[model samples]
Target: MQDSDSLRGFLFDNMPIRGQIVTLTSSYQEVLKRHEYPSNIACLLGEFLAAASLLGATLKQSARIILQARGSGALKTVMAECASDNRVRGIARGDFKVCATQTGFKDLFVDAVLAITIEPLQGQRYQGIVPLEGDNLSQCLMGYFAQSEQLPTSIKLAASTQESAGILVQQLPNHAPLEQSTTDWQTINLLIKTLRAKEQLHLTHNDQLYLLFKEHHVRLFDAKDMRFQCHCSRHRTARALISLGEPEIREIYLQQELIDMQCEFCGALYSFKKPFIDALLRDQNKALR
Candidate 1:
């Protein structure tokens, strides 16, 4: 429902916690063009992609958040990354299908975990994996906040080839600075729990917040830019090929004529021929010496 391609943040002046929502359109479409993802998998990936965007906003430093789904079923995995500066990219693996009118947490994902990774611009990556507690991505996220963070959090996420959108609500501590209006966290949590997924997908950020917190003072920040970008190239792929070992490279070259490596992130193909592969291997060995 948003016309802009940016992640937005909002706060209840009298509430204990703040929330973020981000919708990606052009960014989501770019990822879809890189591969022919199954419709249901694409939707799953889109939801996680938007979640990563919101998660990235919660960091205090230059960081990247990756929302990943690993399952033992048809959809092997889906991952999306959003960086401190709002760069967005994602990919989905495996062919997945869904047939349900009103699905629950267990119906769609089956056996899966929602893993969140926080990688700072210059620090060790911190990751947290929570079971897919609900059929919907939002329920799984809510469970994470309630259990891991102990903060009451609610989320709604959606996406298609055309666009991706989401909304999040959180209950902050009473001691937080934003609680001047003195509304109890429990009161706000109840209000947030009433937000339906359909309403979130159809409403604008301001309108949605106004609907819930009309009686309280709220602060909304300007939207942060979001885009599609992949940090991979021929050189990186070539380095990966070099790491595969000279004998391995030679075996493929002597028989197959080309060593082909497909980048899952961008769907780019990196191919090495006999001479090029040999030269790369020699360079690697020389560097090792």
Candidate 2:
């Protein structure tokens, strides 16, 4: 049986190629439970979550990676975040009724742009943006790597309400002859193309890889657990409110006498009374001085 909520990295023993496979079951369900998304939107969000996990595995340091897309169509925005620790969270905002009827990526996200951001624990943050020019998420991500990283990468993604799964294969720089490297990469790409969405969602990592690369010497590492953990807290929420400035805070307080903040990813709610807001503002003022 396929492992649920886990990611595994594998390598081709004979070539400078590496791959990662990720499956999201419980984590995907958790995101769905937090919001009432339509079937199509839910599936798209699942793909984003799975993609984030695969990309997160490639990080060489402690960091967080976010995949976000904004558009003018039925699907207004979708974002997913994954940390080096394998924690994941995602959200989607849009016209659900209209999104439900839209299936193609282009139709669902007209004039959309996808952004990939990497934030390390102690380093500069980087982001890469690409216009949504492909038929699906996998193609768009492949375009990102081709344009930004200059690496030959192929990605396959599949998602349903029940689960989400993705596979990413990338060719690393090798000292081998160019012809040999290109041949090896092309061979692997052809094999990966045989993978179907139903197979990705249903097959175990070992079974899937072996089925695709049984002829090649493939080494798959131990599975790492993936989870749905929102990085939201009262402190972070308070910081965000402070960024809104005192004037905006006071106006909101005047209308409700209390300020309420809810995390879009986890739906956790935090409320602040006038006194707490006053203290926070005082602290901000002191810091400015």
The candidate that achieves the highest lDDT relative to the unseen native structure: 2
For candidate 2, give the lDDT of residue 115. 99
Specify the poorest-scoring 10-residue window by lDDT in model 2. 143-152
Q: Each candidate's TM vs. the true structure?
A: 0.84, 0.97
Q: Which parts of model 1 are misplaced by more than 4 Å?
A: 97-108, 172-183, 243-246, 274-289
Q: Estimate the lDDT of model 2.
A: 0.93
lDDT of 1: 0.76
- Per-residue lDDT for 64-88 in model 1, tens only? 8888888776566789998888888
Question: Model 2, range 201-245, lDDT digits (tens) per residue?
Answer: 999999999999999999999999999999999989998989998
List the pairs of residues colliding in candidate 1: 16-172, 17-172, 104-135, 105-134, 105-135
**Candidate 2 residue spans exceeding 4 A from truth:** none
